[model samples]
Target: MNPALANRPGQHLRIAALLCTLLLSLLGAGARAELQLLDGIAAIVNDDVVMLSELRAETEMIYQQLLRTQNQAPPRDALAGQVLERLILDKLQLAIAQRAGAQISESELDQAVAQVAEGQGLSVEQLFAQAAADGLSRDWVRDKIRNEVIIGRVQQSIVNRRITISDQEIDNFLNTNSSELLNAEELQIGHLMLPLSSGTDEQTIAATREKAEALREQILQGADFRQLAVLHSSGQNALQGGDLGWRAANQLPTAFAIALRDLEPGQVTAPIRTDA
Candidate 1:
């Protein structure tokens, strides 16, 4: 300490006052709140950010499906957070694929797209048109498809490296598990949904069926199915224009799967009763 300043009590008080003033200035400046008006990120992976709106969008569809399936679900916020974990996992898988140099060639991707289109009974252009109607561009769909393929490759590689089995073990496992492992098909589906409320009389149910028939006709006549879904579907996912996305074949209700099996992709089922 400088002897001159140390001897002066006034100097000590002045120094303490200066420190207090500086602390107050910082606090006051930091206290100002900036309002955010638009969407922002829900979570950040190493090289990717999952947007808040994206999480909400994904969860809303799942939430609707749960209700339609007669299953209890958590609150929207809880569902979104849970779904965010899945997004993070996908991001991690993608990063692993990138590190491994897993690649999907353009021709291979093109063929995959064609297969999906053909399976749906749509031309490639029609598939792109449907994707556009749902706010996804062809490039975006391609990129997503590419990422899925890469992740599958990387995961298969990881599994191959981790698992070990002798011929005897393989034979025993196959003998034990073969009967349990019945083959099942998966279906990627979309719906233009309408609900049938309970306690409705037979007359009302018939009327609802008639309405559904009319809409189905319009769809067959080339009216946009998504537009009709937005206008008439009672589903919470009506806002998404009634996309059911994808589900495993066994995941679908048995009756619905049977009905869906005969209908080509992009074809609307007659307004089936919600109770059905």
Candidate 2:
């Protein structure tokens, strides 16, 4: 080592020691906080236990997601009543699922996780990385998926065998709700979106447009469009393979209805954008 550099090192060594101590303190505090959060179960539904921290975490996730969807600032107490109702419902369903001994296998959980990733146009690894980045454990996502599958299976078992959507019921409902439901169509179509924004630098816009065009080209090259939609579409129906289920033509935005009218099954179209 250079003699001058070696002589000046004590200050840096002290700073490094201080930083290590601070880091350890922060870690200790974080662990303590986590222990406090899960110290006890806040509620019991039948044989199932609901931890307070788990309920708060889930409620916060749902609330934040709803806020983003609405593109509005969420009220501090926004829909407090509704949120409580949902939590109660969730508890009831979870209890029922536990009683039925409904279980989700790792394979099933993986498939559900894959579907969520595909819906967001992400690979499973990427999705897991994102969850980690969000300060969420991969196990948390898996447990959520497990509960979803169990509850869904239980609900379906209860309803599917006894309840039916008959053609007669559909016809009767359509007649009774003619103004709201008649003259509607469900379009089965796919698209690639490229947004134009003045705030975006020209180079970024061009690159985004290029990616969008490439996606469209791949779609036309016999790449499964539904699979692609499950992976990449940004529209509301992205999770459902871009399926905009049947609704009255007049109920949709005028521009969207026009586009729907112009589309045909198994046909692809150039990108279209408009405000609703």
Candidate 3:
């Protein structure tokens, strides 16, 4: 409001424009800072990039899911790495599927979404609202489901191409193991490894076996497996509560499959020693 400038409407307008521009510049700087904090390239997967924001969102989703199931989430740093690896794998598989001309129809996507909603005991709209409350957008959830469907299709295609079962083999399998095969269910496995170094003495090996046995006893006595895993496991996923997630019976090692075969849910296997 300089007296001389106040007499000229054009000068006043120019000054007002200048103030507005300055305010916008300040605001833009803040916005840029926030964007930098919230989003960036987390990893490079061939021609694709995994964003930090995506990793965080997935990590949060898994953490919340674990909590809902009454299981403790792993440490953030560990969980983030696990989520990032999964994202990278998904990206790679999606790329492969794309090259193989794998496509998900709109109906397929919708069906998959519906199934997810049903699994969560929510309507589609309610699922969207819950996702939003959890800081995920509807588009993200849809895209995630679509990608999963694509991956599944591609994997099935690959397996079908690789495995050939003759009529004789099928008949033999049915005759010998039909009941087991028919009754087999997918298993969600957890692992905790107490590693032993190479060339370790018998005394050290015996000590490690004793420790493993003690841990197994504690688990059988109702101690939380995941808590103990986080505290004592030296495995790669130690921080992830030693969770191995779900696996098919065929996907597990022969010994593991055998050991888990007769076990009921929540039952722990006897400690099995292995060379590190």
Which candidate has the top score in TM-score?
3
Per-residue C-alpha lDDT of model 1 across residues 9-91, encoded as one tens digit per residue: 69888889999999998777766433433578888899888887667655665565444443544466656655666567778
- Residue 265 error, candidate 3, Å: 3.6
Which parts of model 2 are misplaced by more than 4 Å?
A: 1-42, 76-81, 164-184, 187-276
Q: Which residue pairs collide, candidate 1?
A: none
Task: Encode model 2's per-residue lDDT on 1-276: one tens digit a residue.
Answer: 788768888967888999999999999999999877755665766656767566566656544444443343234254333344445566798778777887888898899999988976889888778667656688987887787778778878987877677999788777776645555665544444444666778899678767777777887897766545535555534434456655665666567677667666676765555631
Off by over 4 Å in 1: 1-39, 53-79, 119-121, 170-276
The clash count of every prediction, one per candidate, is: 0, 2, 0
Which candidate number maximizes lDDT? 3
Quote each prediction's TM-score.
0.43, 0.45, 0.64
For each of the candidates, the C-alpha root-mean-square deviation to the true structure, in angstroms, is 14.2, 16.3, 8.7
| Sliding window of 10 residues with minimal summed lDDT for model 3 | 65-74
Show pairs that collide, candidate 3. none
